[model samples]
Target: MFEAIKLLVGVVSLIMVYRTITGNCNKYLAFAICAIWLRYFLSAFHTITYPSLVAGFSINALGSIGVAGLGLLLIPTAVFTLKKLFPFYVFFTAIAVSGFVNMQIPGTINVLVKWCYFLVLAGALFLSIRCQGQNETFKKLLVAFVMPVSLQMLSIVLGEAKATEADGSTSYIGGYNHEAAFSMIIVSFIFVLGLVNRNAISFRTTLFTVAVVLLVLVNYRTAILTILPIAAIFYFTLVEQRLKPSQKAPVLTIVTMVLAILFFVLSLSMQERFADVGLLVGNLDLIFKAPMYFSDAEQDIMSARVYIWSQYINAFTNADLLHQIFGFGPDSWKHKFDLYAHNTYVSYVYEYGYLGFISFIGLMAYILTASFNLSNKPLGKILAFSLIGFMIMNMATMPLWNIEGLIFFALALGTVFANPSAQKVSKEIGAGHKTSMEIN
Candidate 1:
């Protein structure tokens, strides 16, 4: 019975997402529905009822694939890039070739599956860039999408939920984990939204303040640390300059900064009591104490990420040209040992080698640089900050592989890149560039 309900909810969510992208209903309404569905499905349905059979085809996985496919289909309709589809084609082609090579090498099928998912993620991002261009009202709709998620996160923090892993170990849902990524995305989204709508100073300030508080409660250190600083930079560089020289803007900025600093300090103070942070620290200490407790002290450091990263770095020190070019293949690292590098940069270099890693980095750099260059308008500034937040989160966490993160990134990107007018529009009603005709 629970399985059936879960499936039904998943299907409904997908339909709503479709309607939203196609602009059938108010995008904000559709986004609100989707956010509610996701929160309930993850928190209520997935947790309360364990339906193994139905769970085999989980909503999260299916949604990831579906969004990617849909994005591919819409590429041709985008007006921003003449051959807009080519970037996606090249990106996925690399994943496919590398994935196949990994499969042929001695390793588990898990590697292939992971890369395939990443390829789909690339597709989702491509579509988002397309969508961002065409969807002028995305800023308003995005606020609706983020509100419920923020409220749900607040509930978890206040409710004192236990943080445990499948192996009965303490685990903080840190960077790249589903919860952390979701929180980061929403907070970043809100910040950007606030900046874009800065003309309504009270509304924007209220929203930004709320977002910062929620960000602290989420207790994802990387998300909080990375986003807050970058957001401040973005605001000063882009949003602050637009405001008139008055007592209001400076006063508000000072208040915002003080509150942000206070929140950061309070969150750190509370970390000792938080279950996830305690567990994570405990585990790290245990993993580092192998020398005195056991004879096989060498393997003790395997579980320590710092140790593993050092090892990976050293492993590549004497690697040959061919190995550097083609890489060790997907999941090959796991086959050699039962550990992961836990860092994206190291993981990419180890799996795909130097050439592949450089190519991937270059692609990301191009996307980021291009996006930053285009962020001349109010909406564009929001998109730029959001992209920066996303990039920062990815550096520490692996949400680039997750469905939710991928889709959100895609939506933001598509909306920005697909619309030429997005670049030309001014934040001020009658400043800079204007025509007699306006959307009103």
Candidate 2:
């Protein structure tokens, strides 16, 4: 049964990849599929999931063949030179160089695969940036981005949920693994949608957002921290425009209903958390002594980050110069603590060091500046504000370039930067062309 399920996943992945290799796929659509679904195909074939070595080899070979087919499809527009792809050139080159020098590069094969993954996504970014204003194409990509994710999140919620016998609070982890990425896509969509109408929530957008918000509540990972910024950004960038007289009452009604529903659901599911959150009220001690609360929950929950973060930093400090500067290669966190550094600073500094670290920050600054300054007026400002929210979330989670979801953001930035009005398409990607203070 499991094998059948795995094979089905591989078949679905193969179909999407095949469509992309042919001229039948939207570029953004292809990216959405890759970001949301392709990794599942790989997982279905991994040794731990599938005991058959032949299945493993077969899936890998199939994926490579599909990618090679895409290379052929790109022959006409593949006219990229070193100068055009400078950012990616530096990004991949630095990581490869750093990985080679690291003494702890044990998962060398895995590291190589990761490099290839980054390359393919970077290539997508280049292509998207290189070719812009395909409205029909962009719309299709947006559908691809939003639909699968919505269904996926919904499925996670509908499936089995466990209620703690002690607390009676139900916990539904759902099937969604990439919580941060999911939220980023959600807010980005909200930004784009608001940009489209701007006056008020379109009926379609209202329903879509309410659904996505419910999904976030169930996932409950970045619920509070991530949601607030997204809401605030939507209001500041998309919401607080000089409202037409007609919009006031409807807007208030919608906001009130949405907030009420969200509050009721959240309180019902995680009352324990809500009760503990009260610890923040009246008791200022919990605020200052937040780190002292790890006895309450796991690493991802309340204040546990403080404790885990300390461990990662301590481990990083004691390491030698090689490990300090170059990092321990991709997925090397197991040697230090768990599967990943709970903090971005610890992750980048320990994994790729200053080379990766600086690249991450530089890329963030460049994209954010570009997002606000695109050629398309409403679209640029909308994406810019929405993207600003995404970047802020990224700081607290993954560095910009490392996470899968940011692949879309990078692609969007590339598209924005490539626009004729914002700035000329420089021969260099991250070469020193500064934005005007007005745009920034």
Candidate 3:
């Protein structure tokens, strides 16, 4: 049954890609992104049916090749402006230099090419919005995202695959490699849907939010810590326009305090590594101290993330000047450590070096600043809150390390930096508000 479902998804995704390429669908980039994601489901199904093929999967890997191909074909259709993409350009350059310096040319090239594909995806989105307008393009995007996500949600409920945690709790990971990754997809979908439904709250939106919250709470308890606050903020933002200025501040403050308390209590209920949240809090002093100073017991806190972080930090500090500047290489942790750096900050510094690290941080800073500047815009608020939740998730796990997370990142970046002109957005929104108010 799962095999049949996976095959159906693959066929549908391929058809979408073909339609996109032939100009039958203006959602060319959306379908292209869909193809990349659907490929994972197909690959997972293949692996399940034939475990022997697992070895070959890694060897034959061409990361996001599906999107890259479509993106390349669409290049002429879209103007490849770099003004909004300047930070990405710098980060890419730094990583490429680091790859060459560390003699990890093959690995670096693979990583660089993968991101370049996303750049093309961003450009395609830019062109789509420019040519078709934001509302129409976003409606298409909702369809594209919903088509694949429906299958993923189905897998979560009915698929045989499950993730067993250290404490013997089993998480329904659906088609994803990890529960957290699967939940990231859910969160991304929710935020985008919120953007689409920005005109008003509806039964569908409310129900979807409730379902997503339940899914995250059961499958990935830690994510709820972030998602709860985000969802609360989103609810407040949507309703704030209805409230008088005098009511807004007190309502927000009271809700925030209540949610904070609830979040604290919920954190203590997490299983396995996440249950160590209190232990992590108690060891704040030890965490900031030098890695070498950490005792064995203290190192074991937070699923040994402290120890893993220390190892990466110390390794970087002890490296020669060139290595320190450029870092070991993309994914150097595979060779350098027994465990992956659970922290994105530590991992980037170790793999990309300070140059790449600083560039990446600058990229994030740009997104945050841009989001803040456009906060009054509905899409802007969604991007800001979603980005905040994503970044907070990264403190413990490397969301950027996987395709699902990168897909969200690409979507967020593409939407934010793709178009600088808000005139279209304003006109559409003004028109929408007039119509809505008339009906009301």
Candidates sorted on TM-score, descending: 3, 2, 1
List where candidate 1 sits over 4 angstroms from the true fold: 1-59, 74-89, 104-136, 143-160, 164-178, 184-204, 233-242, 245-303, 315-320, 331-339, 375-382, 419-440
Whole-model alpha-carbon lDDT for candidate 1? 0.49
- Model 1 per-residue lDDT tens digits across residues 1-440: 43453355456645645655567444333433344345334533434432333436455445444433443444333332435334544544555556566564433243334334444333333344343423334443453343334334434554523342222322222221335445545554554455353563446656665666555555555566556654565455544555566755776678577658865776677554333444545565543343334334334332344456555656665577766766777656766656567566777777777766776777666666556656356455556666676666664455544444554555555444444443344454447655322112
Best by TM-score: 3
lDDT of 2 by residue, 1-440 (tens): 43454365456546645665356564644664455345344433345432434634445434543553463454334433524445655655556767678644545444445444544554554455444333423433444343434444444455544343234444332233344444445544543344344333347356446645654544434334445544544544334355676886778567657766766786677566555434534553432243435454533333344455555566666778877777666556766575454456657666777677787677666666666666556556656655665554553455343334444454455455445454443423357655322211
TM-score of 2: 0.64
What value does the lDDT take at residue 266 in candidate 2?
Answer: 64
Q: How many residue pairs collide in each prediction?
A: 16, 1, 0
Error of 3 at 228 (Å): 3.8
How do the residues 229-336 of candidate 3 rate in per-residue lDDT, one tens digit apiece? 467666667667567988989888876777677666755555554656767777666555677788887777766777778788888888898888899998778886
Candidates' C-alpha lDDT: 0.49, 0.50, 0.65
- Candidate 3 minimal-lDDT segment of 10 residues: 431-440
Candidate 2: stretches off by over 4 Å: 1-85, 103-119, 122-134, 143-159, 162-203, 235-303, 399-403, 421-440
Residue 136 Cα positional deviation in candidate 2, in Å, after optimal superposition: 2.3
Query: Which pairs, if any, clash in model 3?
Result: none
